[model samples]
Target: MSYTFAIIGRPNVGKSTLFNRLVGQKLALVDDTPGVTRDRREGEARLGDLRFTIIDTAGLDEGPKGSLTARMQQQTETAIELADALFFVIDARAGLTPNDRAFADFARRANKPVILLANKSEGKQGEIGAMESYALGLGDPVMISAEHGEGMGELYDAVRELLPEPPEEDEEPEALGELTDEEIAKRPIRVAIVGRPNAGKSTTINHLLGEERLLTSPEAGTTRDSIAVEVVYRGRRFKIFDTAGLRRRSRIEEKLEKLSVADALRAVRFAEVVVLMLDSQTKFEEQDLRIADLIEREGRALVIAVNKWDLVDRQPGQIGALRTEADHWLPQVKGVPIVAMSGLMGEGIERLMKAIEEAYAIWNRRIPTAALNRWFEQAVQTNPPPAVSGRRLKLNYITQTKARPPSFVVFCSRADAVPESYLRYLINSLRSGFDLPGTPVRITLREKANPFAHKRKRPS
Candidate 1:
């Protein structure tokens, strides 16, 4: 029921800057270099009291067929088609360029209301460029500075005139009632597949969707941005984010490539479950371990996908060796689910999907306070706390604070004195006792304050 707007413009026109300002977060990567944004990222934006979905698209340009730049432009065209309106942004300081004039015509051809945004309009030169934007044939330009957060009120007013009014409180609500738990679970799960370049990330996604929705090529780094698509499997829907393959930081030097890597990282942080795709031929590499470690640190449910299974020789201990390697290299996420499949041949996909479901359920699993304290008592009795400074560390109680990675807080006499080994022992016990394998379990220690310390003597 929300309105959607696509912020379109030529390269280096501050579309991303405006997107960050509206969303109140740096969800999209911004750089001084042109064409840093190569994919369309959607975020819920707010200005004053108006709230809507805003999409930041790659700068419009004409490129040859099948080239990287061409694919970027195709992404922009797709955004335009899906948008309810368009914010055709121009660099007011640079005045109007041939690219701006040409894309203005493109935006008009979409047959949607276009709001001309003259960004970087803080000085006399910017004002001159804003006046020049009137020549593009779009309506009056709204001069603003996307970087310094200037002229948002004018932007809000222009957008308000184009948007439909919200229904009154007395009016009937959409669909008549709140959704049940089962009905709500029917919503798609947000899953992000990420790994090193040419790891068959795209191929695996395509095979799962049963269509060629994503472009696949043998060339490394073929996917330059994170692309999202929805698919229904066995009555459970999934919203999959296909991200660009990441390389080691030393190898990534290009400005555009850096942005793509940052985009993929953002996808990982936003996703509920992240599937780290690995090439079976290459097996476990340093970067693969790093990616897995990142997912663990981010507290997202993880599933290890050993892609390109078709090419590997079927050895007697191949699967076992692969799993052992996964556990050895990525000990941070112990017992992580590992599924080997050939994306080209579409083998073991069902098993992979099942693993994804299991991980998600475990990620959301929460333990009751009574049950948690019971387990904590047994765990502490089995392995007593280590003595620090010859004084036994007193462990008082434990309780689960939240789920979705299963966070807990342990109140003790001295939180700082708890040994790292003892904490790991408790974490492992909790994982095993609660049936929470392959999910990040966060246990924070807090010192119990003396309840009587704040009391004042009565009329003493």
Candidate 2:
């Protein structure tokens, strides 16, 4: 488990700067211009002993309901909801404006612990204005100059006091384990949009989010970083990532593009469901398959988005034939969801969301141990483990250890002899019998048979 914190304030107040500071790099676009950062950015942050995820929210501004700024506010609210604590930053030199107070009011009403930060408090002149932070009622202001690199130690102390202990790593089920069907219905679907340069990745993200959180341009590759946004669909929160377009690394020469492509791959690893967005006119490109291969290799749930569908000339049998061919060509990513979407017009986009949700649900599905073993026994009975070097491998049992790309370990006498094709057969069986669709399934063959089931008995 990971603890997360959000740095939020009005525009041009160096929220991005503070974010870059905490994250140890310039992951967020920092500009003096107001609203340069229109979306929330998240990064792995290390604040002293605290190794936690930190979110940089868009600078809030007061605006009318249903307006673009209003949508931005809604995005910020969602961040507050997800985070364990809030770091409300205010410009010390520009002290206690109406907008700052307004944002502070919203933060106060939410009842989360807030650590008030008076940024740009490096000089004696800054100290005079930092004193005015008492008006916000968010507690004693921690002074820091993000650019000049001051007061990080104090910020670390403040965070340690406010936030709860970080969630431990490992796929251990809760003490009250075996979640009911009702609980499954509540888990958020995490989706990552991926493709080559300018495959309408950001456009698709904007359509699903119902607002423009990503900066989209006609340029071939406008998004040079990964941006994550949260949206609620049918009462369930969905964390969506709009990643930088991947270009062939061998062909990519520039310094910045290298970093961007790496960022895109990072997003895929973090995501349970990945949407491989493609231009409908340029369907089934070789590069597309390579991108899909990466997802399959990573063992992630997959959805294929044929974007710009509205622009393409659609014959009745054309799209169907393409999907059929994809199923045949891509065996590793069998049963992958394929949806045609027009990101510009928002047509066919709902199906993409549905496919993503379905894929996510499948990825997180945990097969019961008894049911898994029963299936295992029947599978082995029908097609027994083969003789390798004239020795019949004694396969004992199988158990599904986890989900999020369903993983299983098969306890067998000879782990090395089991061919990849045979493992695929078992994987396919698990997918078909368990009704898990559009998600990667992993099967590991181990020489040891059910170690947890029995204790060793020395010669009696």
Give the alpha carbon lDDT tens digit for every residue of 368-457 in model 1: 999999999999999999999999999999988888899999999999999999989998898789888789999999999989978878
Candidate 2 lDDT over 209-306, as tens digits, reads: 78666767677766766787788876778888888788776889876667668777888998878999888878778889899999988989999988
Winning model by lDDT: 1
TM-score of 2: 0.67
TM-score against native, each model: 0.79, 0.67
For residue 308, give model 1's deviation from the true position in Å.
2.3
| Highest TM-score model number | 1
Per-residue error at 84 for model 1, in Å? 3.0
Where is the poorest 10-residue window by lDDT in model 1? 167-176
Q: Rate the local accuracy (lDDT) of all candidates.
A: 0.88, 0.82
- Where is model 2 poorest over a 10-residue stretch in terms of lDDT? 167-176
